[model samples]
Target: MVDLPGFKTFGAASMSDSHLAEVTGVSSNPGQLRGRLYLPPSLQRGAPLVVALHGCTQTAAGYDRGTGWSTLAEREGFALLLPEQARGNNPNGCFNWFTPGDIARCGGEAESIAAMVEAVVAEHSLDRARVFVTGLSAGGAMTAVMLATYPELFAGGAIIGGLPYGRASGVPEALAAMRAPSGNATELAQAVRSASAGYRGSWPSVSVWHGAADHTVAVANMDATTAQWLGVHGLDPAACSTEHGAGWTHRTWRGADGRIAVEERRIAGMGHGVPIDPSGSDRLGVAGPFMLDVALSSTAEIARSWGLVAAAEVRREPAEAPVRRRLVPEVMPANDTAAPPASAATSGVGQVIEDALRAAGLMR
Candidate 1:
């Protein structure tokens, strides 16, 4: 982990470190996932919960620290579940979204994640109806897996620079899936439907985000992702409403219930990272590898859509220590020995920048 030299977590100067409370040890079942939970100072009953997944080569702590989910949770009086992928599972630390076993229901990482969510709900005074999930890259892909496999689990979710679930079974196919094939949107959505059979529940609303210039995961994947959710929600992609953001565009399609079922974001001139707002306004995470200092904040945008925060209203509560406990993995099923998802290897220069961004934050 790089100490970001000269950089402090936004507003860390005035806030006590204890305000960012986290407890390590909750188990991600079936997969025995190593995971942690962030707590807010004041636990309001029925508060919203967010399950955040990190991108490749990033740890749960690294992603939470950089993205400021803990900070947001504390302020908004919500809880967080940040799950980490073990190195043994995938050397690159990317979620195994491409693996068939991992993406399937009641099995592999997907089932384990659902189990983790149950763990969080069991212990806390949370509103099961208000759960949401989001992730970046491979994490983003896994977010799609969780939302699709267990559509009843989430109210909404956001995917940043990710592809549709069930589109690939391995690395080679994953690479090919990024090209956004002819009429790819239609194909991707159908693939999601086939992922789970005989499921008739309200599909989660989706927020799809991708930089127009993202080279790591082609922007085309965003189109396919948008199509996947729109198809699930049965909304016409062409008949959508549009909202403009600084350096980005948001397109939404309201469902029959008069609520947004699908929304897509196109960040202009951005790259392969979660967009961060450098200005004090809308700041959630730090600027580092895969964490860009763009004019928009995906975190803030996502939270508002989830109904966790209000427009122009960001809260910061007093410091409160969190409950801590050690994780105890349940006995694995005999037939399941698959490892958690792994991260993908990127270029040397990209590694340097990512490491430097991490280092800069750490150093401060």
Candidate 2:
């Protein structure tokens, strides 16, 4: 277990909420993880369920408070499931995403979380087809693990500051991948498919977010993640539409049916954290360590993309006619460079690996 920094532990009082309660009686919790469920008062019998995973050194409620996931769930009338990482599992309270046993389908922590999801859906009579999952950093990487191992279980998934699936199989490899993720579109896509072989079902839609200035996890991982999902969806990487905003850039790739199968958001000048807008019209999320104030709420935007939030709930500008075109950043910033192409060899990253490991609290 590694001792990481930048996250504060909340007390038991912070973990208590009226609508939030313990998720127990899971008959197949092989990962030995604890869970909390938040059912909004207005939740209907077939409400949507969102499984939100917190980053390292954070509690479920603390993450819920910072990201406003429960608050959004209340307003949108959706069910919220927060799978917590126990200290016993990882001393840093980070999910064991790189552990082979934990990430394998129907085993270890992945299976434990899957069992919790199944129990919640069954007991609450929720809509199975509308279930979604999302997470931050380590939780975000685990999100990829779940989406890869159990694609049939999720309608959509959002990864914030996370790595691609199967990029690492242990802590040292995980840290090295954090410093620089390796693989091209085809290789990365094969990793996801191989995770769940012999399944020819529809893939879940994906949303990815990363800070341009995130030193903890390089922004290049965002591109690697996007490439992996785009490969899974079989969409051309150069065929997406781009939208630029005050503090971020957004890209979208549509499937043959004209629906967005994979989308990416690159936030300018932001660091390693979940971007939030606490004082926005929606008043979503609180700013804290690893929860940044970027004037754009990832909570609201992600829910909106998921079709869980209504237009009236979010303040909007008049819609502009979008021009379909491919836009690429011509020059990489000083801190972030283009990731190596498919199967590219990597070297001279010892210091970078060390720095990233320290940033993630994975190294002393």
Candidate 3:
């Protein structure tokens, strides 16, 4: 049996609440990356799947503990897939977001993660159509890689403190890009297109989250991220942007089919880290290390923004909800990016478990 040690965190003790979340090994791990699956006790056959990626120096369990993703999966009836970066991949245990070899479509870290996703989808009998991915910092940069390379696989993606895709080919270039101002929106979007020349399918909806005071990654990168997605969706750069809850400046763009393709959250005064909501009402993760409580819950808000939480998932009778759990960012400076129409990110996962069992040669 693996030793599961409990840890404490600020805000609510939500990290401790994840004791019940069981992390299982993937049945057939094709991805060079290590894969872990978080399954709630009340698991269903065709629940939605969420792929959660960790940042630099973070292990899958550490990030989940602080972020409360496993807890959220339990409450929301979703399955969680965490693709962890091995230390050898990067000295800091960061995904190779800056390495050209790692982000390619068919091989390296990105494709390995995709293989992991496919295996988990089969193992859990998950609804493939409902898949979504989210990440923070370096992981966030990798998240952008996933969306661009595997647009046909994910419905939507959330990037927290991440730079634009294909912005850098190495660590030095990554550092420079992270500090640069948001570049031409059209050019930024074109980078994504160039990354995957043949993928012309419906682009995944994007949600951008960045701290206003993030010194590690310049706040301007958020603008570049927003601009990149906006240009992809063909939205006007000067479209009117608006304010949402707690100084969250937001803008959304929709396609001719009436589907919202992109949305961005520019949090005022937030610094480098994943912002957590101190309010127990909506707290999703704990505050530790790169996780900070800054009056708003990025995890909860992003989940809702991703269109995953149904009314029943959040509004079940109080008597029926599980009890216990204590847990769990600065807002970025304001920019003049105007809000477009109020469209938001679209939301997802099923599998033939027995078929997977046979494929893995675990069953005949």
Prediction 3 global C-alpha lDDT: 0.69
Candidate structures ordered by TM-score, highest first: 2, 1, 3
Model 1 residue runs over 4 Å out of place are 1-28, 181-183, 313-364
Q: How many backbone clashes does candidate 2 have?
A: 1
What is the Cα-based TM-score of model 1? Answer: 0.79
- Counting clashing residue pairs in each candidate, in order, gives 19, 1, 36
Looking at candidate 3, what is the lDDT of residue 350? 18
TM-score of every model versus the real structure: 0.79, 0.87, 0.77
Q: How high is the CA lDDT of each candidate model? A: 0.72, 0.82, 0.69
- Of 2 and 3, the candidate ahead on lDDT is 2
Q: Say what the RMSD of model 2 is.
A: 7.4
For residues 95-160, what per-residue lDDT tens digits would candidate 2 score against the true structure? 888899999897899999889999999999999999999999999999999999999999999999
Off by over 4 Å in 2: 1-7, 10-18, 312-355, 361-364
Q: Listing every candidate in turn, what is its Cα RMSD in Å to the true structure after a full C-alpha superposition?
A: 11.9, 7.4, 13.9
Candidate 3 error regions (>4 Å):
1-31, 181-183, 311-364
